[model samples]
Target: MGLGPLEIGLIILAILLLFGYKKLPDASRSLGRSLRIFKGEMKGMKDDDVRSKDAVSTTPVRGEIVPPPAPSGDPNAQLQEEARLAELRAADLRARADQARSSDSSR
Candidate 1:
């Protein structure tokens, strides 16, 4: 039969009588500590589940058939920017070469 409050109280009283008042408090304190530890473990498990659910819902990998949007500044723009930078570098190198050659000729 399911225990009502009266039945539960009697069981608790019996336990207290068996263990004595001095030991009952200590036993209850240990039980409270165990319950707190169990609650903490359950919370951690729930947090991990939420994290995995969020990861699955967000962000895509490379090979998915439904491709992610191309990033801003397309390849053509990047290539043109790279070419411009190359030209600037080449010009700088040419100027340096000319200065060296002129210095040698003057000497």
Candidate 2:
């Protein structure tokens, strides 16, 4: 069964009471901006996924004897690069977990 009119009305009334007439519009506008930002980021992520897939297709497979594409820019650059990439991956994982938690909470 779906939410009847009464339930929907009650939900609206609850929201109105919580936000008050003056702040409601501002709250809704902020929500709209947030949703727009979220939509744009999701689109960007899809584009990035496509690009990464293309990059992966050209990358060497495991156990293949592939020479390094270029010499290190600096002696310690490779080590720093690896550490930076590892940190980025960890951050991505944390963001995914946080997104999952927020979605679950919203439901």
Candidate 3:
């Protein structure tokens, strides 16, 4: 019925003839190694599931969706203040240069 006995024997004979006896052992060993690797990968996935279950969320405010806290002071405003100070220093230097030139010409 399902490939009787004679057909099964013929199929075995064909497989043996196509891939000799020694080659069959080697092929089976490599197939076994591949199966072992597949089993290890499945076990690794189970380990990952366990790790995820054990992990804790790190946020202090876990439930609140608050906007980020504002900076203590604005950086742009501080930078503008520094720029104004630098401009005043440059104007003072230019005035000093003009006075020195005037005194030198008079002398």
Candidate 4:
């Protein structure tokens, strides 16, 4: 048979007795925070999935010969490569920031 109101109340009373009234609020707050973080991460994963799909669509087919990155030994050439990579990173950050701003504004 299913539990009635009295049974449910007794179960709740047992829980309160086990955990105490003071600890319940702290435990619930911790649970809420954990759920919030979990939801945010799940949202981030969905966004990553969309980004990966876009990347896959744009990517070249299998068997294509992709060129390797620049050599590491030469100091001047390494500096130039580093500079180029830094610029690329800056551009990517700016683009993402802009996208975030636009999404925020739209929302």
Candidate 5:
């Protein structure tokens, strides 16, 4: 059931005949690009899975209101608070982007 070297060679020959030598490089380049994009998307999905797991692990239970820490007058405390807020904003943006991408893909 497996293709031997001769069969494989014939397939390659057929492809070459269908697409001349001048076009072969372009075809291969496109194939490589497609493969790279596919790999990147797979990696993104894995990252999303890990991120979801981490979020789940750190999330507060239902009916809980985890308020931000009380404001401290210290400058360092303010900077830290700002940094945390920035991270939250960035996460929100990423979620939106992911949603958009999913919707686009569905279409």
Candidate 6:
């Protein structure tokens, strides 16, 4: 379900006839330049995307999760608060687990 060599040759022949031998070279040269410009623009867009991602991740350490700003707009304070809360949650869970174990042993 692809174009055979015969089909491809006929298409090329039709193009050459439409553009004529005199104009075909110029037309192909312009098409090549347009493709080159389009490729460069696509590469530029990818570079811009990478730059934007780097800008957003402004943390000093790579791959570190940045905590959202608190009401005071301090990133470090917000991170510390998040860490404190996480530690508290872990302690609560550990206490609950110990209580459960003690009850199970008594039973």
Best by TM-score: 5
The lDDT per prediction is 0.73, 0.75, 0.70, 0.76, 0.79, 0.77
Clashes per model (N, Cα, C within 3 A) = 0, 0, 0, 0, 0, 0
RMSD of each: 22.6, 13.1, 25.4, 11.5, 10.6, 18.8
| Model 1 TM-score, 2 decimals | 0.47
Off by over 4 Å in 5: 61-107
Off by over 4 Å in 4: 59-107
Model 4 C-alpha RMSD vs. true structure (Å) is 11.5
Residue 33 alpha-carbon offset, candidate 1, angstroms: 0.8
Estimate candidate 1's RMSD in Å: 22.6
Question: What's the TM-score of every candidate structure?
Answer: 0.47, 0.50, 0.46, 0.52, 0.54, 0.51
- The list of candidate 2 runs beyond 4 A from truth reads 58-107
For residues 4-88, what per-residue lDDT tens digits would candidate 6 score against the true structure?
9999999999998898999988998999999999999999999988985675445322344645557877789888877775565
What does candidate 2 score on TM? 0.50
lDDT: worst 10-residue window of model 3:
55-64
**Displacement of the residue 11 alpha carbon in candidate 5, Å:** 1.6
User: Where does model 3 exceed 4 Å of error?
Assistant: 1-3, 56-107
Candidate 5 lDDT tens digits, 78-107 = 778657665765576587679999999999
Query: Model 3, 13-50: lDDT tens per residue?
Result: 99899999879999899999999999999999999777
Q: Encode model 4's per-residue lDDT on 22-69: one tens digit a residue.
A: 999999999999999999999999999899667544443343433345
lDDT over C-alpha atoms for residue 48 of model 2: 85
Query: Residues 12-46, candidate 1, lDDT per residue (tens digit)?
Result: 89998899989988999999999999999999999
